[model samples]
Target: MPHKYHESQVRRTDAVEPSEEEKQTQEKPAQKEQSEEEKQMREKRRERTERGREVGAEEADAGEKT
Candidate 1:
């Protein structure tokens, strides 16, 4: 069999290398700094989420008592 293209013409993904910034981002853990407003929003959302779970738990406990 004869190949139409040469070796250099073929694209190889493995040859691609990550840059220094990319490598650093991967190596170092990301630290997200949220603003005061963002922090308050996140806290409120978290409390709202846990509130549902708490309600469910209370209902389950009440059912067990019946």
Candidate 2:
């Protein structure tokens, strides 16, 4: 005896378009603004993080020497 299998089929359909209001909301959002002081603080935090990494690496190398 031989086994029998059923075949599957798919139907094509047109895509639904978005309404005017939906299109507007889907558009790009407004840019955000940051204050000068906030920007400066952010940069300072980044510099401190990098400096900390360098110091840690130096300490590790020194420890290995002892």
Candidate 3:
């Protein structure tokens, strides 16, 4: 009598090749440049805040009656 198999078996050497899109995603550097741009944006925002404060103080004094 022949023996019966109870479970499915997978080969150890089988490997699925990465798709083209996956390869491109792995090679992309957009995130690194995005963070640098974000840092620059924050610096600009701080500069704007400082300028606004100076303008606001000048406006406040100009509006007061001496």
Candidate 4:
């Protein structure tokens, strides 16, 4: 008896080649230097995000305790 499914019956898609422009963009772009003020602002934003997460967790725990 023949099997109900066969690998040969399955269709496969071929990989498309990237255009010249796409290939160029695929390469890593130059990184811009960040100024001191930019760096400080990024750090402050990160700290605030983390603090918010901590407060949310504490509130969840308080709800579970009560």
lDDT of 3 by residue, 1-66 (tens): 854643342232222556688777877788778889999999987876676687885664564435
TM-score of each: 0.33, 0.34, 0.41, 0.34
Cα lDDT of all candidates, in order?
0.67, 0.59, 0.67, 0.62
Number of colliding residue pairs in model 2: 0
Model 1 bad stretches (over 4 Å) = 1-34, 57-66
Better of 1 and 4 by lDDT: 1
How far is 41's C-alpha from truth in model 4 (Å)?
0.2
- Candidate 3 Cα outliers beyond 4 Å, as residue runs: 1-28, 57-66
Which segments of model 2 are wrong by more than 4 Å? 1-34, 57-66
Supply the global lDDT for candidate 3.
0.67
Residue 3, candidate 3: alpha-carbon lDDT: 45
Q: For candidate 1, lDDT tens digit of each residue in 1-66?
A: 999777766544434777688787776544333356678899987875676587886775575579
lDDT of 4 by residue, 1-66 (tens): 988656554332212566677776666343223356678899987876676687886775575579
Q: Which ranking of candidates, highest lDDT first?
A: 3, 1, 4, 2
lDDT of 3 at 60: 48
Candidate 3, residue 38: CA error in Å? 0.7
Clashes of each: 0, 0, 0, 0
